[model samples]
Target: MTLRLSQLIGGQARPALSEAWLDVHEPATGTRYALCPDADGEDVAAAFEAAQAAFPAWSTLPPSERARWLDRLADALETRIDDFAAAESRDAGKPLALARDVEIPRAVANLRFFAAAATQFASESHHGQAGLNYTLRQPLGVVGCISPWNLPLYLFTWKIAPALAAGNCVIGKPSEVTPVTAWMLGELAREIGFPSGVLNIVQGLGPKVGQAIVDHPGIKAISFTGSTAVGTRIATSCAGNLKKVSLELGGKNATIVFADAPRTQLFETLLRSAFQNSGQICLCGSRLLIERSAYAEVRDELVARAKKLHVGDPLDAGNQQGALVSKAHHEKVMGHIDLARAEGGKLLCGGNAVQPPGRCEGGWFIAPTIIEGLGPYTRTNSEEIFGPVLTLQAFDDEDEALALANATPYGLAASLWTSDLRRAHRLAGRIDAGIVWINTWLERDLRTPFGGMKQSGLGREGGQEALRFFTETKNVCLNLG
Candidate 1:
């Protein structure tokens, strides 16, 4: 099917007036399968204008009514789970299984979770000796949500659901590279009778539409997810107006495997963590810090497992891995591998970009890569490569492991593999990351605050943190005469 995607403005689908279009390709086949609006600042200004106009009605609607709309949106998305998964896999170059089971379901859950959260939204109250103090949480007017290409609809809804639930009109823009599922969302919202301008989408490159969003005076808060460099740009841009901004940015997360850890379980889980979605996720562990005692044993097993992974068509059930999101990204990942080799890292397995036979000849496929012998501060080890590339380093003890894990400027996430419960808690607490997983990776709770420390990101999202970010707090005190 030849797909032509459009922008959503005032709950309607319209082609961008920018007169430019981006070809949307299926990375699995390296085929141009669709076209998406290459929107510009004009589209962004229109979206903001619509959202700004809709803010009063949408934000003042009874929370219960808003909750119902959200519930309907969830139901609509749930019913089309297969459709979304298929589209998302093609757009993002992720495995069909991952999309069907993890990404799409989480997108559904985001809507339902926020729908429920809206009904029971709370405020703190304090009873003092002479007066009563009450805190009020009210929606910020028009807010902007910009999501990355990695997870598309999953993270797109993660930001949008809460903004709408908090009674804020939203101007949302999905990554131009993976706008398929988000376009579907725009369709569903209009069909489900969401109020006009409640949720608007503007499709474009970051420098254009994204910059417009940052500069817009009417948008009160902006939630963004992407690279640390881009996040820094957003912070600087939003600083002039002092707009509320929340960023979920880059990471060079670590997986610490202790000697006492279950060898089999660690290897199996580590494979998924290192190569899942081709390691495009911000939370994926690109650095492995193995205890010296079990370093050799674990390294050999992990390399063997990486060799067995099937890399081919995304729609193929037998293929365990899919294509990279784009040819540019594929080259970037390959460049990182070359840089790793130059830095004196040993390429243990799978560093070449492959041209799989038949339909995927031109597809962007990189074998699951493993590197060793690089120092903690090496460019390949410290930078956010954001690919299926992992660097291995051995640590002598817990303190050494901690040092290696936190050495990078990023403090996004970390995974610890240890049978020792005390060490898990001790090390987890001491780790600089905002999210730490013990014996597991990518295990998420929607209610917990999710974001990184240091350069990884600023602020948090998920559950009440999302609602809180989209709204303003006002304290009202009653004095007794």
Candidate 2:
């Protein structure tokens, strides 16, 4: 399918003023599938103007009425699931089934979740002797959203649904590499009857369009999901203006498996956690901390499971894993695997790139890898690799396990596998991550709050907590005579 790119401004698809374009590659074959327009400063300015124009009405609309539009969007998305899935897979290098069955559907569920929460937007009043006091949660005027490429559609929805549900107009800049899906989402929003300018999408590089959105005087808040370095830069940009900011950044999350855990179940969880989306997830369990007693056994089992994973064309139903986002990313992941070996980390299983049988030769594919004996402070242990490489480290006891888990600069998400309920509860509390899964990994419910502590991110996404992030609370006092 041929896809053309345009800016979604003021509820219309308009050609970008700049003639510059980016080639959207099909990861399965490393072929340029489409060309997406790269918006310049002028385009961003127009989008900001449209958002500025739309803010007043959107913010003032009754919560119930606003929610109705959101519901319509949910319905529209449900009907076009197949299109979204295919586009998402083609754009972001995700498996077709994952895009169609999981990512797109979950995004719709998120929209509905936020829509229901929108109706509960109410000010609470308390009578005092002096005056009546009430707390009002008001929307920030215009929010600038910057989403990354890993899970483009799902992450974009994470920013958009809650921001809109909280009555804030938005101008979003999706990563140039994966902007097509976001542009399509903008088109979907328009079809569902959202007011012009309520949601504007501009495609461009970070320094050009993304910076403009962040530094724009009209944008009241900034929500960014990307690397820690980039997130820091965004936060700094928003600082002088004092614009509200929510950042979901990088993570080197750890998965700890205890001796008492069910080995087979643990192996499955670890495989999915490390290789899902080719391990590009910010919350992926990149570091595997196993109890020393089970290290050899766990390593062998994990290697066996990794060998069975099929890596190939994303469109093929039989392919369990797909290519990385691009050739550069493929090389970067392989570099990390090489670095692990140089650092004396044991290569227990797959490390080199592998082309699955009958798959296209040019695709950016990497085999799922497991490396052992790396220490907590080692490069492989401390950094967020952001690819299909898993580093293994052993711990002598529970204390060592917790210590290794918390050693990284990130505190995003972590998982624990153990049969003892008491240890699970106790360890969960001690873990510094935002979300801790017991005997599971990457099991996300749209209703649950998800984010991280420290370098992982600031603030949360999902559930009622997300609504609060998009809004500002005001205390109002009145004397009723």
Predicted candidate 2 versus true structure: per-residue lDDT over 1-481, tens digit per residue: 6577888999999877877887888787788888788788899889888988999999999988888988898899899999999988888777999999989998888788888889975667889576899898999888888999999888888888889999999888888888877888888887777899999999888998889888888788888999999999988988888888888999999899999997656777788899999999988899988888998888888889898998888898988898899888888888888899999998877788866556467788888888887788989888888998898888888998999999989999999999998999999999989999999887877678888899988888887777888888998989888
Question: Per-residue error at 144 for model 2, in Å?
Answer: 0.7
TM-score of each: 0.98, 0.96
- Write one digit per residue (lDDT tens) for candidate 1, span 275-376: 999989999999999999899999999999999999998888988899999988988999999999999999999899888898888899999999999999
Runs with alpha carbons beyond 4 Å of true place in candidate 1? none
Q: Give the distance in Å from residue 454's predicted Cα in candidate 2 to where it truly belongs.
A: 1.5
lDDT of 2 at 451: 86
* Model 2 spans > 4 angstroms off: 128-130, 356-359
lDDT of 2: 0.87
TM-score of 1: 0.98
Worst 10 residues of 2 by lDDT: 354-363
- By lDDT, who's the top model here? 1
Output the lDDT of residue 45, model 1: 85
